[model samples]
Target: MIENLWKNIKKKEFSSIYLLYGSEAFLINETKQLVIQEAVDLDEEDFNLSSYDLEETAIEVALEDAETIPFLGERKVVLLHNPFFLTSEKTKSKVEHNVKKLEAYIKEPSPYTILVFVGNYEKLDERKKITKELKKNASILEAKKLTETELKNWMRQRASYNRVEMDEAALETMLQLAGTNLFLLTSEVDKMALYVQDSKLITKEIVEELVAKSLEQNIFSLVDKIITRKIDEALRIYYDLLKQNEEPLKILAIITNQFRLIYQVKGLAKTGYGQQQIASVLKVHPFRVKLAAGQAQKFTEEQLMKCISLFAEADYQMKTGGLPKNMIIEMILFQLNHDLRK
Candidate 1:
């Protein structure tokens, strides 16, 4: 939900000091731009729009201005590009020396002045006292990456807002191809949207043509087949991917997940874990859990137990560099296929 902060952004409620720090610079920039657009009238730079790179300057210019009145001209926005100020103990302490100087100003930041701090640091010590003060005194919004579901939502929203309609399969395909990288997905989705302008409904076929195919090659269907004891279909898909250059370990990973799901679902169902609980236990989306749980019926409790050992062996082999990754995966598929047919 926090990943969708841009959707919840309200320009009017802009805070005095904003800490925009994250790997997802898109959110940081998008939110900052939205706030700036709302706060400043576009007529001219009535408020001094100053951007500072902390590597170059102390907080004196940025934090000190907190006391000064808006020049007769208008409000001044001091943009601190890098809060290396809060970076290390030495740098952070040097910066913290002015907590009072900043605190005095933060208490009543100039109405016309907006201080923006962008740390972009890899880590934030939320436990530190000064960190607590900065976080508490300012609007500390961390830009988090989107999860799979949230990424799906993002792709749809981006297409719809841009007047492009991507169907469910297409969106799913896009998500698969895009992986979890929001920044890359955002750009790729936009590019595809512009290309498919002629079509209101972007179909899976169109997605296949327009966007890149997913890495696993939709091996989820194979996951479904193997779990349902549809050995024939499962092997068919497995062989298809292998012939298409799909690595064995990759396929093994997906199949291992399948049996693990069966064992999980059966265990949970026996415990009355219900769909929701099973989904949570498996860390899979609920709809997917529901399907896997239904498919779990094909696996006897004994079969599930036995296969767990097989999967364990495969995982060990893969992790220990015990076998070529593909052979390790092929062995898993062969075991699952043999057991299913038996």
Candidate 2:
């Protein structure tokens, strides 16, 4: 886990070669920063720190720098970014990387240099020998998105790190409001931590008061209200979104997307697919799948299809100027609520 790796890095237990690869930019960036902060002093950054874009440069070039002695410092930190060769994806750059040199370097890395490979890729080419060798030799961190449980734990840890207590309801509310983006979540938690510093506790009310909802989250809540048959609350959220200058067509698109997800999740669940399986198949976060699953329970497949049809009609009317965009959404909401009541 990244937490274990972070703890080790904090203790100054350095690894000679580090591999950080995944789709999550926040995790990759955070781990890289933590390594650099713990490995070298500010004064040594000029001579001891180096970065190379592997797409434009050869791997051996970085290896040569890694082998070189650090000037005015005991250790050197070399950041190797965009190691596209590690993954199956091909890059536009024609720079030829000498994989043999990388393989040999991995086998016997320079003790005086901290070599970090930063591949912002979802997965590496596991069939490649160099990838296998590096995995065997280096400290690895696959900085992927965290699961719901992992996210909650990480938020708790972040609050604790800031000397604040985040209650369970607050955590859930934060997740609901902010979605699963780690960068936004970190900012919200830090801001709330500072807000409740005097009390040293974050309650659900504090979270509701502080965390700003994204457009997508607002759409989700609007859908949630509709599902619960709370037309007033749903309209209120829609009005609030309009006051914030959100386009009605954009809102309609997201509402359509959410209903589509609910339809897909419902169908998949009926076929015995688990939440993670559905998430993987749909290429969405598991938490989103979980929420869609709950919303799916309140809808039959046919009802979801009808909701999607209404959204489609709304989209057409908004684009064709048949009705005012705001009225189109309002009408769709009312139509959906009326259908649910029947």
Candidate 3:
């Protein structure tokens, strides 16, 4: 796990070569910073740290830097960024890279240098000789997206790091409000920790009061309130969105998408598909799938299908010359509320 990697870094356990590749930018950047902090001191950073853009600079240039002796420092850190050549991606750079130099350097890496390759790729071409050689020789770290449980645990750990305590329900509410965006959620967590300073415990009330909901989250809440027969509150949220100048048709489209997700998750669950599995099938984030699954449980398939049909009609009415967009959405919500009661 990443925690183990951090622990090792703290103990000064250094790897000569590290290949960090992934789709998630946050985890990849964070891991890189951690390694740099451990490998190079503040004073030595000027002379000891070197960064190269593989697109602009040849691979041989970075490898040469890696092989050079450190200047006034015990160790050096060479950062090779955007190694697109490792994958099957067509090279857009005019500069030519010597793959043989890279392979040779990997075979005999500098004892005094920490050579790090930052590949912001989902998956590298495994068939390449250089890719295979690097994997065979380097310590690899994958920066993949986290699952729902992992995301929640990350929130708890981050809260603990900031000396704040978050209850489980509070954490869940925060996640719902922020969705699965780690960067946005991290920023929110920092603000929340400061909001409850000295008090130190984050409550569901604190989350509701302070955490800003994304538009998607607000729509989810509106749908939840409508499904549970809180018609007045649901209408209030919709009105507030209109007050903020959000387009009525865009709002309706998102609501339609949400309903579609609920229907899909419900069907997948019936077939013994787990939340993560369903997310994979739908090509969406697992956190979204998990939230939709919860909402799906409150709705029967017939009711969900009816809501979808209502959404389709509302969309058409908005696009064509039927009612005003706001009125159409309002009428749809009112009708949905009436149907739910039946």
Top model number, lDDT: 2
Best by TM-score: 2
Worst 10 residues of 2 by lDDT: 314-323
- Model 1 compared with the native: what TM-score? 0.60
What is the TM-score of candidate 2?
Answer: 0.94
Query: Worst lDDT window (10 residues) for model 1?
Result: 89-98
Write one digit per residue (lDDT tens) for candidate 3, span 1-342. 788877887788988998999887888888889999988998989999999998999988888888899987789999999999889888768988889988888888889999999988988999999999999998788888877788889988989999998999988898889988889888888899999998999899999999998999999999999878999999999999998899998999899999999999999999999987898899899889988988998899999999999898778878888678899998999999999898
User: Judged by lDDT against the true structure, how good is candidate 1?
Assistant: 0.68
What is the alpha-carbon lDDT for the whole of candidate 3?
0.90
Clashes of 3: 0
Would you estimate the TM-scores of all the predictions? 0.60, 0.94, 0.86
Candidate 3 segments exceeding 4 Å error = 43-47, 88-96, 300-303, 309-328, 338-342
Better of 1 and 3 by TM-score: 3
Worst 10 residues of 3 by lDDT: 1-10
- Could you tell me how far off, in angstroms, the CA of residue 157 lies in candidate 1 after the best superposition? 2.8
RMSD of each: 6.5, 1.7, 2.9
Ranking by lDDT: 2, 3, 1
lDDT of 2 by residue, 199-229 (tens): 9999999999999999999999999999999
